[model samples]
Target: MLAFERLGIRFGGNQAVQDVTGSLTPGKITAIIGPNGAGKTTFFNMLSGFYKPTSGVITLSGQPISGRPTHEVVARGVARTFQTTTLYKNLSALENAVLGHRVRTKAGLLDALLRSGRERHDESESLKAAHHALERVGLERKAHVTASLLSQEEQKRVSIASALATQPSILLLDEPAGGLNPEETARLMDLIRQLVGAGLTVALIEHKMNLVMGLADQVMVLHHGQLIAQGPPAEVSRNPAVITAYLGSHGGGGQHGQSAPAGGASV
Candidate 1:
């Protein structure tokens, strides 16, 4: 399990996340939901090692990992996707995915310069891994395509392929359904479920309550950097504090087709 103990972060005098504690079980999908400025992405940043928490500890299967560098975290079996797609636009999808295996490669600069046997071996392994990752995300056919030329949904899948190439135990996704149409969103949802079914732990920060309610095994509600409620979706959805914090007067009722509020905090 991935666990956070009283995790908190402060930006100057402003507290972005405070005393937030939670555990994400392996092989399950956990959804993080909240309104603008609710610190949803801030929490994700800390988990992915992009931000070092000002206080508290984070542990994965009993090993402390808080404040580790991002690459180190990836090496430790955690990989993530951002709200904004991060890809090498000029690179082919397969090449971009191959880059994700950098942390696991042992070939040195000297090996590359000399074109040694080890370099060749590692390169071959990386290519195979990249192809498998793309296949997992249903993007194998687009492997040779330039990232910039793919549709938004395809770009998102490429990003996911890159993360999968790392062979992570935990996958953190931020706003994956952000700009997707309903059909695309449904496909993405099915993909996520398939991943979880294949024994991966997924934690997503999503604005779409419909996706959250339908897909998550556990739901965590954040409000102004604090965890206001957490439980199964049915339970969290009915919590009055959670409703006031983000669900609004609809009480999460009409959230099926609605988007999140404008200018929501990113991190």
Candidate 2:
């Protein structure tokens, strides 16, 4: 599990995130939704160690993880995907996914240069894991495809597959549905649900209200860089402050409620 207490960050005089508190538990999905500039990504950056917090602490299980370097955080069972799908454009899908296993690799550069048994064995395992990750995202059949040749949705799923290959305990996804169409977003939602069913903890920052309300086990709404409401999807959808700040722009709670169909509703 991952927990944060009074977590915040500042850039010079700008308080991008302020005193937000929450937790993500095993086999559950936590959706963070907000308008533009709500500091959702800032919270994720701090949690994933891309940015050191200006206040408060983040912990995984019972130990502090805040302020650690990004690689250190990944090494400690936390991995994330960026809002932008990051991939080696020229690399095969399998190759890009294999990079995720670097955090778990034990073979040294020297071993690779010498083609030692250890390097060969490590590579075999990494490739196997990469294939498994690709399968999870339904991309195994395209493992040899170049990253640049994939469609937009495929690219996003590949980005997720690469992160999943890291064998992380907690996965932070920044805007996983940012640009996908309705059908693509539906597929992505099902993929995310499968991940939770497989016992991985997921926290995602998404502007797609429907996904948040339908897929998330818990929901957190952010505004002006702070949490205004957080709870189960139905409760959050009805919060007066949440409506005033964000959801009201879409509709005041009926279609955005937890019972709403995932494929319907654009806000």
Candidate 3:
């Protein structure tokens, strides 16, 4: 479980994120939705330790984790995948995932140089972990392939597999469906559901309203750096504030260039 209480962040004189508060339950998917510049990414960066929040606290499993270093936060059972794919083009998919397990390796410098018993054991364990992570993401067949040679969708999966290789209790995904086709998006939804079914908590920020509506158990809407709405999909869809926030910017009463079914409800 996680909680953000009255979270606030300012970039110079601009208050990018203003007093936002929410919580994420274990074994559930929570979606943070809003138009561009809603401060969703800023909230994520603060939670992930990329930026220290100007105010409030972020607690993971009841312990405050605000202002911790990114690496330290990751070691504390949190992992993240960016909007854009981040992988080693020269490395094989398996190698990239193995790198995620780097923090867990016990092989010392001398052991690595000499290929000692400990080094060999660590290597074998890391390999098995990497393979297992890839398998979880349906990328096992691409394990030995070079990352640069894979398609965009495949590359995205590899990025997720790498994050999973870290064995996180909570995963934060930014725009997982950003560039995927319909089929790919469906597959991604299935993967996310599977992860939640397996008891992993997921906090996702997605522009793809369809995916969010179909997958999120709880939806939180942010507008102008503030919490505009928070509830189940059905209630959120009927909210006037949400409609205005989505539709007002565009010419129509509640139509933002595209129609996003209310509440991140099922598509």
lDDT of 2: 0.87
**lDDT tens digits by residue: candidate 3, 105-181:** 77889999999999999899889889999999999999999999998888988999988888889999999888898
- Model 1, global lDDT: 0.89
Please give, for residues 143-247, the per-residue lDDT of candidate 2 as tens digits.
Answer: 999999999999998999899988998899999998998899999999999998998999999877777877899988888889998888888777777666654
In the range 1-267, model 1's lDDT, one tens digit per residue, is: 889999999999999999999899899999998877889899999999999999999998899999999998999999999999999999999999999987778899999999999999999999999999999999999999999999999999999999999999999999999899889999999999999999999999997777887889998888889999999988887777775665356655433333333232222
TM-score against truth, every candidate: 0.92, 0.92, 0.91
Which residue ranges in model 1 land beyond 4 Å of their true spot? 247-267
- By lDDT, is 1 or 2 better? 1
lDDT rank order: 1, 2, 3
lDDT to native, each model = 0.89, 0.87, 0.86
Worst lDDT 10-window in candidate 3: 258-267
TM-score between candidate 3 and the true structure = 0.91
In Å, residue 30's CA in model 3 sits off its true spot by 0.4
